[model samples]
Target chain A: MEITDIGGVLCNGIKEGKYGLGLVRVRGSIAGVFTQNKIRAAPVIVCEENIRDGVVEGVIVNSGNANAYTGEQGMRDAREMCRIAANLLGCEERRVAVASTGVIGRKLDMEWIRKKAPEVYSGLGNSVENAERFGRAIVTTDRFVKKAYSEKARIAAVAKGAGMIAPNMATMLCFAFTSAKFDSGELYDMLRRAADKTFNRLTVDGDTSTNDTVLLISTGKERVERDVFEEELCSVFYSIAKQMARDGEGATKVFEVRVDGARNDEDANLIARAVASSLLVKTAIFGCDPNWGRIIAAAGYSGADVDERITLSLSDGRDEVFLIDSGRPLGNEERARVLMEKAEELVIRLRLEKGNGKGFAIGCDLTYDYVKLNAEYTT
Target chain B: MEITDIGGVLCNGIKEGKYGLGLVRVRGSIAGVFTQNKIRAAPVIVCEENIRDGVVEGVIVNSGNANAYTGEQGMRDAREMCRIAANLLGCEERRVAVASTGVIGRKLDMEWIRKKAPEVYSGLGNSVENAERFGRAIVTTDRFVKKAYSEKARIAAVAKGAGMIAPNMATMLCFAFTSAKFDSGELYDMLRRAADKTFNRLTVDGDTSTNDTVLLISTGKERVERDVFEEELCSVFYSIAKQMARDGEGATKVFEVRVDGARNDEDANLIARAVASSLLVKTAIFGCDPNWGRIIAAAGYSGADVDERITLSLSDGRDEVFLIDSGRPLGNEERARVLMEKAEELVIRLRLEKGNGKGFAIGCDLTYDYVKLNAEYTT
Candidate 1:
């Protein structure tokens, strides 16, 4: 399978910078996931309504206006966007999914989109340049484009997000295409399972957005084993998730928390997410202070079954330093400090002597640049 | 009630700096609340065990080390502190409580405490200067002392905290004295209710500590109506809570979110806490941007039953500007910006079309200084 075509063009009445429209032209069975946030964007609502039959021809996405909380007019604008895309692609409107990201409580510039939709459609092609353009067009505060390709399964994935990120689909937009044959049900199940382990285990600032959407489309050009396809799908998703964490607004390093030996998968996931979402732990990591107490405290308050007999270690992928050995302080500050200082990606490994469950999460350090970027975000 | 005696002394063998000991001497019934974090500090454990009998003579506290995760030795150290205080104050060992704050995963400097405890005990006296000293000694990163008094009900309170603050008691240490006559059970009930409304409704960085403790001691020197006593207690707690929010590390403004017309009390509180705890909302406030979308999105994801018909307004306790009315955008950015710029205390009032439940929460804006203070806290 392969991507048929992709294109991106400025569509918010701006010639350059911060706002644009992107289009992906591909015919396949589709499986999608949207934000669980109560206040969903207009595009998310329309897409949910249109994707009921699990068939899709293309996706239309925009940046600089979320088109959320804009009442009935917002809903109409979302439908009109799908209509324009459908007319251009010669597909049913219901087969054209739409997504938006950016400032909430605003209406889409429909006139600008109506004029630029044809341009984006005309430029569609299966090229690295087109993929990069689509990735760049969908970003608001993201520092760079995020794209991952799995040659073994012939899958390509692109994601865009920087802030307002948390579990249950962060403020992000992801579109993936594959050539392997798979029904909508199989695709949905595989996508959900992969996302639960990747995108759903990421937190940047502990803020879930109103317009998060992820779509997986299969072109059915080739067939592969189910296990092979699933493994490759997860690989692509993991790559994009790590990129999102590394590029978190104002982030200098990626922080990963892995929890093992919990009573159940739920408990393990809870503990891992708590550590990754903790602001104190993030700041401590940013300072390279090796403050294990913050990590333990976060686990304690995670509403999971935790006890004193837990071991914790710090790792920089090459070396590991144990800070706590089964509730006993090792006082290995020197080694821990050295590891934190030298590690580009910091890993906090917690082993609880409870059961046989494991989970992990990825996050980024809290820094002054995060405050600066977010403070001036909409001003 | 009056503060019979209060004193503070440097306890880390330092003449002056960020480490000290504080003492409060009184003799009456006492009620206390400790952190809900599963990893309790040694002092918190000792205090919980000692306060079971609802009797107290005095309190001993230090701020150089949290005395947490020290195992058996930490417990022994906490008891020894209470024993020392009891011996000096001529009371039973079980009648004295102990508390510690500052760096965690460290042993208490028992030798220094044993030496400095006498100085603090000798200097104990009821005076504004003594209260100020007590306030100063317990602070780690706080820029100012936090104190509140109720004249009509004869209640006085002092709190010290700057970071690692969240609901169910922050990393703060608060001690309140009252002359009104009340049983331990009544006092406990009153303290819990008042604290639930005040201290428990505050969030700075959403990081609850393992060493938070709040004690309310009664001298039983005066008889007052229960209603009046409870009112004064709540007022004093409110004042101290607001102070803590204002003094939050690197904070420039106090942000309050009040939610009304929720489906129930729990929903209202969840919504308020969600808005107050959103880093995005806090950063937007720091930049003085009238971005109501963040507030609305926070409420939407608060695990509450919210809809589009909610009304939202911004106020500085003087003029009010409505940003959303009955699901419609009012576009009152200019007025909202003026209010936010001029207001030291920013209030976000949200009215839902669901029910009659109401609740509120207090928080501080996320700023560069906050990141600086916390990142370099233990380093």
Candidate 2:
């Protein structure tokens, strides 16, 4: 599969004979979000620079080794990646940002990429198969290819993320390219909002990876209005982000926990995150146990300012719901059973009695498979 | 079978007949520490007061509902519990403390406790059998009786905690009564310090409960010196605490993760916790995969300052130790076989190149039984 088939994107994978492997995925305009880690990677630095500049040409990604925690050598390699991609595309290096993911502390295999760049540049195509292939190539541990397309705007997005998800930002490495023409400023705003609403709202195992990145690019092939293009682009990106959350390693069911009527959005987010990231709560969901006590208990201690009189409703993706309020469980067993047996996905709703702050977080069930994948990873 | 059998401790379980159940277990003079939670329960307030007064003649614990989040009413209940015990023991209420664990929000069932206070007082005894009953009466969801004794100092402690355990705290309810006699102040300080090294180092599921309490009482029957008593008491508590971590719902094995050579103790603790609480890491341990990648990966992202070029060793409680470093496994087939041959307790040692930071955290292997337990909990 190749990214070029996704309407307006072009991608090339290079075996930089020495530096390992390199990939260039481009779109004339782009929208993106970076990690919130205090000690961020090189790609985040470049992405922020491009977004702040109000113009972005494309993103260059490399795998096999992460150029992180290596002092100045890391920074130099990031700049070099941008420079190489820029020279080939006839654009400013700053407009061509870079991202890398792999083992940390290792230097880039620059000699390898330096030799393979030209061959990769000559090979670009547009097809769904190609897009899927690009998606698979970008992944580290992801089991499925994550791609979403919106026919109305002729935009498509492909993401790579298998694990390292949490409440704040998913520890992911994603490259999304689209052909829709849109203003760079609008694209940046749309990306940020979409990320806050999607990628930032997921918790896989509460471990935030140090090398997480999400980059969106526009090829400007459609040349649509900025607002129209952005709407479609955000929709596509949202779909991809949700898919990433759903396809989290060992995840069996996707959960959307909505917390409302809190003292503030931060409080709501904390409460939601508490429930989403709780191993007990997640395991219960996986077991199909309607353990409302665990859910309420998590919310109660989430450090959020909530009143005891707050109302809570939990559902297993259906009309059936369980209520807990005033520190007691309410409703009959049949209703609870119906809710528990209803759906594979669960939705938990909480209405705090403190204020009107609201928030939503997405999560997945914790299963033995999750343990299997993570526990023996190196073995 | 009882906490009293461990050594020397007097206990009474009071049911008021309507709202709550009350208990009073006393040590002659044993050490105690306080909770870190700023918003503490009323019982915690009483415990602190008694500790400060340099006398811990009695502890009054209640279940059926936590006397928390109730403002003044909660305080009254706590004080009343102490007063009732104090009057019975011929001591000041200031010397009698209180603890509560159960449903949050509802006021203490004062009426029920008041009605059954006489019966509870009548049942108080100095025998080990009474102590065991005290342990059982204080429990909520624990599957087995948790009691520990160290013959070196004739010190014994019993605890009831099956869930809601983390680094910070949990719905953990523990009461340790000993025959060794020490001043109240000394007992309090030693107990506090021992707890910091023991119970505080264990985590069941990483969820901190709002109403967690641990109390130590001395019956003054055995006159052990402060040093010897502290050593034995701490050793006993650590054993029980380790048991608590091992007996966590669905937990298969207890893991003692020792992380040394970090920037500080806090840093070590953070890294150890990150590795111990990781579902993937725990699961890998269950499968005996010796997956060093997951361990190192979790450490890399544990929000701690760590140097990747550090030493790693795994000990399976026998004559086998495996070494891994720089992202590679270095153990031989015999060691690997030993790690996989047994289902006994395991210890993981991680050495970082940061400063001097030492941390220890206890965890359990993730297994299918955990899934089954949690899945069937609410159903």
Candidate 3:
């Protein structure tokens, strides 16, 4: 798989990393998934319409002003973006997908797009620098660029999201490219299944956004076994999802909640998501305090079929400390506290006695910087 | 309608208000509501069982340890608490209801209870000071006393909760008394209806506690009109609920999100609760920034049938500013910012174009103190 060309231009011409226009030129069949939010952005709507035919020539994404909730003007601006990108890339207008992320309910600066689209297209090239630029261009409050490559499967993926994240998608924007041969139907199914297990099980502040989009384009340049391809695809997605959580607004650390032995898969997912989305649990992690009661309470209120015969433990991948065994406190305060203070990556393991179902979710600690970044975002 | 007798004893023998035992000895028919969390506390289980016969001669409450997930020993401790209270108050053990709040999975210090329960009962008296002590005794992290009285209907209520609050109940604990004559069935119905509208529509940290309990007792001393009693009962509950929001852990301000013109009441409620529970929205309010996009995005992803033709406005009771009108940005930034900065109590009003359904939720701003308090709660 290969990214034939990619480039980014600062649409607002500030170069302060605030506003950008990204262009990725490739010939492939595309499959995409969008935010389930009822009030989708205009760009998301246009991309949904464009991707229906399972063919795409390029992608145009802009940051700094989300073309959302701007009424008819927003829709027109989104389509005009595609038109500009298609005209420069020598592709049909309906074949060019468009995406935008930033402050919601704002109109896009059409003049900047009209000027930068051609410049970005002209500078397109296949290089690591170009990939980094493209990753940087699609971020709003993100602290770092997110990119993942699977050498074995020849797949590359980029993602941008910091806040406004929750299960079932968020304000997250992700794009992947591969030269492996796969039909659009197969690509769509694979992407959906992979995302359901990765992106759909992530939370940051528990606020799903209005402009979340993920696209996978197969260039059909090589052939690989379905099992190998699916495994690599999932690995790429998992890496990007972890980066999204680690860079969550002002996140200092990222954690994963794994639930096992639930009554069913649904119950396991519910418990894991509830714990990951709980503010109390996030704050406790931020403070490096082993407050297991909040975890239990979150699980209890998660509408899952939970009972008293549950076990909870914490780990840093190497060392493990049991906080509760069979729903009884083990009072391992000192060891748990030390693990929390020292762990680079934390994992909370909860095992129920109901059945053999399992699920997991990734989340970030709620820090003061998160509040500061989001509170002062639009101001 | 009257306190009859109320008192509190320092259970842990520390006068700094860390722990206390509260006893309210007023014979009446009782109606109660408990947390819907699956892992109910031992005290919650005891209360549920004792209230089945609709008789409550007294209530024994403790702060600092929640007898939850303590296995069989916790159940025995809870029953023993009721027996101790009943023996001291000269009431049947089966007629005494018990409630507890604070850390989960900790066994109650039964020694303190056996020593302090009689002391608290002996000092029982019908006085405002006694009521204040009782209120203080039931609080864990609450910042101030929460109590409300209705002179017209002879009703009084007290509540204790600051964090771990959400819709469908929380870590909140409330007790109300009235001398008005009402049957247990009527009282139960009234309390449920009032709580459904008031306490059930509030959010602080969006974490429902396992020990939330509310009790309403009616003594046969006065006879008020049914309509007047119900109206006053709702008013009292609303007052207590508002206080709980205002005193939310580390909170400096409280706000209400009012959603109107939704497709149905359920949709309206979903939207209101989503907006209120949004951390981004709460932080924006805390920063005094009118980031209306977060509000709109929260509404969009609330699983409600919302559209772009919604109007959003902010008010401080005396003044109002519209941020969005009919899906168009009004750009009233300066006015909205000033209102957010100056308003003592803020109200966010959203009008949808679907139907005539309306709902409202009360919430507090997210602050650094909230994170600090919860992070260090168990440590």
Give the best candidate by DockQ.
Answer: 3
| Deviation (Å) of B135 in candidate 3 | 1.5
Task: Please list the Cα RMSD from the true structure of every candidate, rounded to 1 decimal place.
Answer: 3.1, 5.8, 3.0
Indicate the residue-level lDDT of B214 in model 3.
Answer: 89
Candidate 1 residue spans exceeding 4 A from truth: A1-15, A164-170, A203-207, B1-15, B164-170, B203-207
Model 2 agreement with the true structure over A1-379: per-residue lDDT tens digits: 2356555466655432223343555647666666554346656676577566656765667765656554567678788878887877788888877777665555677776666666666664555444444454456666776877667666666666765333322247766666666666767787777677777777322345556777767777765666776677667766776787677777877777899888899999988887887777787778776665566667766778754555667776547464666534465545665665667677888877778899988777877677666655543
Give the alpha-carbon lDDT of every model.
0.81, 0.67, 0.81
How well docked is model 2, in DockQ terms? 0.27
Q: Which of 2 and 3 is the better model by lDDT? A: 3
Better of 2 and 3 by DockQ: 3
lDDT tens string, model 2, B1-379? 3555544356755333223343555646644554443345677776776777555766777765667656678778889988887787777888777777765556676776776666777788866556655665666656765778777687666676775233332367777766677667777688878887887777422245656777777777767777888888788888788778777776777788899988898888888887887766777677776755556656766768875556788777665565656433464535664675584788889887778889988887777767666666553
Chain A superposition TM-score per model: 0.94, 0.85, 0.94
Give a tens-digit lDDT track for model 1, residues A1-379.
2233312211111224657888877777889987777888899999989888988887898888899999999999999999998998899999988999888887778998899888888887766566666777788778776778688887878788775233422378888888888988999999988887788888422346789888988877788898998999999888888999888778877988999998887888889988887788888888988988888888877877887788999998889999999999998988899888888898899999889989888988889998898788763
Tell me the tens digit of each residue's lDDT in model 3 across B255-354: 9999999999899988998888878888889889998888998898888999999999999998999999988889998899998898869999999999
Of the two candidates 1 and 2, the one with more favorable DockQ, higher being better, is 1
Regions of model 3 farther than 4 Å from truth: A1-17, A164-170, A203-207, B1-17, B164-170, B203-207
| TM values, all candidates | 0.95, 0.78, 0.96
For A135-205, candidate 3 gives per-residue lDDT tens digits of 77788778776778677776778888876233422378988888788989999999999888888888422
Among all windows of ten consecutive residues in candidate 1 chain A, which has the lowest summed lDDT?
A6-15
